[model samples]
Target: MYIPFDEMVDTSRVWIYQADKQLSTAEQSQIESKCNSFLQEWAAHGQALKSSFQIIHDKFLVISVDESFNQASGCSIDASVALVKNLEQELGINFFDRTKICFLVNGEIVEIPLNGIKSEVKNGNIKSDTLTFNNLVSDIRSFQTDWKVEAKNSWLKRYFQ
Candidate 1:
């Protein structure tokens, strides 16, 4: 069954999908409804999966699952992918694009194309202290930690030289 995000354990599994662009208010509401409905019936091995989701930065879709109850099976994971595909079709939002990277500069969010990471840093657009989002985080615990990191201390560090 769906639970509030804050109620889920810190170790809950998480999946972060960042949109290529910020979503409109209407789009956010629609996506929220879709996520809620999906989580309400989300189950694993016929057992109701305790899950929740939230939107962050008006550009990210964060889904969490408390696997302490029942681990999500391959089929359930496929179902979640299907939901994202349908939502992408319906909203024209691209959730699978990994070339877009996000970070914070001057207390604001900035997006840099991954393909141009080298130039972005070489030109001083991305700095060492910039909080870059490492969307590769696999669980809530990691999401809370590695989801954001200093560019110089992360994969982006290579570009600095």
Candidate 2:
């Protein structure tokens, strides 16, 4: 998305929790270790999938295989999605929110509030990136659409090439 940095409506920022205040040394160490292990496993799975199939875009990936291969692999998209969701919950980071197009200006990262952004997921336009948000909504609407389409198409071609 071609989000102009000036048009970003920063809503709220998250507060970082102090390590000493939130967790004990042992507990924090355990959490960190578990998180690292989870990340390693997640990366390994993603690498395996990428090596096996063709990735189209950030949101959509497809693997073309015959019945024999499909049966032999038995890869479940639902399970993958569930695992991602669980990982996000454990890590306290939203993957979809991170996918937003950010505009950098003067060494600062600007973000648009997703509160009023109308998602097109309800409709059949899953490929559309035209987000409708409050305040300068029209200006930023086409920004996301153009960028997403171009990036996805470029990535797909590059992957195939």
Candidate 3:
């Protein structure tokens, strides 16, 4: 789950493992360490200086950071993109791809198009504003239950689970 660094508000946590599994202490510690390292590397990114983080358990972690960085400073889009690129590099995951992910902003559905140049907002207009990864994660978590049910009922459920 990728939360934009800028929209991070209150600390957030999520489970990284299934509850049914009984992990050995070593395995659990390894997962925790990986999660911690993930957050640390994220915070170490150029635009992530003001961010703070903590790992609660093998399953959950919290990230607390200033939201002021949401604002782009002039023509520093390179800096902004660099932050994302660094995250992708560190995570070995593409966090900024819109094709596989969708965002709901203030009730509007926004999708990162195939081209990745801009997002297409559905059911509402797109506002000219920067959105943080934290905010997106929060929103998704809030609607997670509903999404889970919906996914289970759809053909995509096999792929998701």
**Which residue pairs does candidate 3 place in steric collision?**
3-133, 3-134, 4-132, 4-133, 4-134, 7-132, 15-59, 16-59
What's the lDDT for residue 143 in model 1? 88
Best by lDDT: 1
What is the C-alpha lDDT profile of model 2 across 6-89, one tens digit per residue?
333222111111111123345444444543443233322233221121111222121221222122132434443454455446
Top candidate (TM-score): 1
Of candidates 3 and 1, the better by TM-score: 1
* CA error at residue 2 for candidate 3, angstroms: 13
User: By the lDDT metric, which is better: model 1 or model 2?
Assistant: 1
Candidate 3 lDDT over 1-161, as tens digits, reads 23453455543322121111223466445544654455444432345434433332232233443445432233333433454355345544443443443333564333444344232323223333423122234322432333222322333234323
lDDT score for residue 33 of model 2:
55
For each candidate, the alpha-carbon lDDT, in order, equals 0.87, 0.29, 0.36
Off by over 4 Å in 1: none
Model 3: how far is 67 from its true place, Å?
Answer: 8.3
Clashes of each: 0, 0, 8
lDDT, candidate 2, equals 0.29
What is the Cα-based TM-score of model 3? 0.28
Candidate 1 per-residue lDDT, tens place, 84-115, comes to 78889999999999878898888777888878
